[model samples]
Target: MALRTEELMLNMGPQHPSTHGVLRLVVTLDGENIIEVQPDIGYLHSSVEKMMEHRTYFQNVSLTDRGMDYLIALQNEEVYCLAVERLAGIEVPERARYIRVVMNELQRIASHLVWLGTWGIDLGATTVFLWCFREREMIMDLFEQVTGGRLHHAYYRIGGVYADLPEGWAEQCQRFVDYFLPRVDEYDALLTANPIFLARTRGVGVISRRDAIAMGASGPVARASGIALDVRKEEPYEVYDRMQFDVPVQSEGDCFARYRVRLEEMRQSARIIRQALRGLPPGEIRTRVPMTMKAPRGEVYVRTESARGDLGIFLVSDGGETPYRVKIRAPSFSNLYALTEMMKGWKVADVIAILGSIDIVLSDVDR
Candidate 1:
């Protein structure tokens, strides 16, 4: 006897918990096997670029916090400020530069913790969600002490950071870093060797190195697929060139590989922060930049290694206080497109595992 199977079209979400945000997935399935994946975006679109053009250079920094990936708001501010600084030919103080590196790396850890917690929840590892956030709270507390805003810090300014690091802040940060290093190992103990996690993530939704590069995946996703494209190492922005760290890579390009890449990144980020804190200089945290400053008539594009991956900003100044055009090269936007390629030919249940692994933020994608 012979039996025929027909494809079933299923809509995973505009509201599903695993979609991460307001993203909808139109998936084709033959029984439990996935035939194709079409990611439906634009649900969170707010024309962030157009909005940036209307606001002053200073105002746009705050706008970036709200519009882009809120989870990594400091990185968003860092890229914007970096572009503006280049256009205006501003020089950041040595101390401010080191502080920026330290703050940005801490922000990376916080953002990754959020991803780990939420991803764990998606994979039904409820305990990991709680454990990841517990350390993340300490990171947030450190940020609050410095920037006064836990989520949307807007701590970075045009020339440098908003203010100098408070007294003993470095020591406090060091204490937290020392405490947090072991917590990462605890997370590995909880998830990496767990039989259930390996079953759910290993060999599911594989994206080969060629496809990863061809489709523009980055950060942990592309690195997991065996691509060594990292803006921090290749471009060497800020104090990254001085800091000693490694770019973790895996050839598997599956859900578990992505998981491993991020887990390793947390350790590297902690290492970078420790180094920055150890060598932190004493000086002014910010350079003198007027609030109503006008950038020279020029166009500049700057790229930085954000938590997700290579985040870039293209700024065009008409010799005015406000920008003429601002285009944000969001890593999540490009990373989201790779989902279709990765999700193809996988089972329906593996969808959550794969999507969570990619770590796309809809606001960053849709902005």
Candidate 2:
């Protein structure tokens, strides 16, 4: 007797919810196990780098806000501003630096909350989605109070931020920090040890330490694989060096490990924000700079710890009103490639679980 088993091919998304944006995956399956996974991206491609070259240093702040990683608009603005500030030899005031750290940490929490909520939905925990958003809304309200715009806040400038915190803003932020810490505990109670979540995430989509480094995985994704590569700790910017926090790392390198890393990161972010509030110096919010800013004729590369991962901006200045060239080193783009390695040997159903664990935004990948 002889038997023949044929391999099958399937397309997961160009419009699927789990893909997180217009991402398509071509999966080759041997019965229930995936033999290969090819991620099809670029559906949401927009030439953000090209746009940066056309816009002035100030104008590009807004452009960076919307163009790359919409969720992490502040981080985008920070990296861009850092590059220009370095080239121009502008020093951010001590108060502004602390405020920047506070806002950046708040932005990190907000972005992680979005990831947690959507990741819960992807994993079929609808209640978690609701709770996570509840926390996120509070952070958004705080942001709106300071910047006027919640998500696309062009508050960061070439020299410093646009303005100072409003009256009672510090007290309100401290209150939010106090309120938000307990909620993190609630999430742990809900899913950290739940059998179903454990069954789905643990031991699934495992990435080896060797593969993680070689593939250029950063942030929690690489940290989960036992790689201690955090931009904040490795290379501190703003007041991060002054602030105290730990980079959470897990050696499991699976979906569960990634989940643990981010959950711990939220707590650490809160700690940083609290510290920034306490030590925030009182001074001018911004340095005096002309509306049309120009940088020295040179190239600079600035990196920051974005919510997604290591977000770097390479800027070339020709001593002109606009940048000569701009290249964005988006974290999601390289992390997307690592998906293929994670998906191999897992079932189709595991695809959603693994993809959610990575917490990728297609806009970051396509940009």
Model 2 scores a C-alpha lDDT of 0.91
Tens-digit lDDT track for model 2 on 1-367?
Answer: 6668899999988999888889999999988899999999989888888988898888999988888999988888899899899888999988889988999989999999999889899888999999999999998999999999999999998788998999999999999999999999999999998999999999999999999989988888999999988999988999899888999999999999999999999999999999999998888989988889778799988999998889999999999999999999999888888889999999989999999899898888888
**How would you encode candidate 1's per-residue C-alpha lDDT over 1-367 as one tens digit per residue?**
7779898999988999898899999999999988989999999999999998899999999999989988899999999999999999999988889999999999999988989999999989999999989999999999999999999988899988987888889999999999999999999999999999999999998999999899888899999999987899998878899999999999999999999999999999999999999999888878899999999999999999999998999999999989999999999988989999988888899999989999989999998
Off by over 4 Å in 2: none
Model 2, position 193: C-alpha lDDT score: 82
Computed on alpha carbons, the lDDT of every model, listed in order, comes to 0.92, 0.91
Could you tell me the TM-score of candidate 1?
0.98
Q: Count the backbone clashes (under 3 Å) in each candidate.
A: 0, 0
Among all windows of 10 consecutive residues in model 1, the one with the lowest summed lDDT is: 159-168
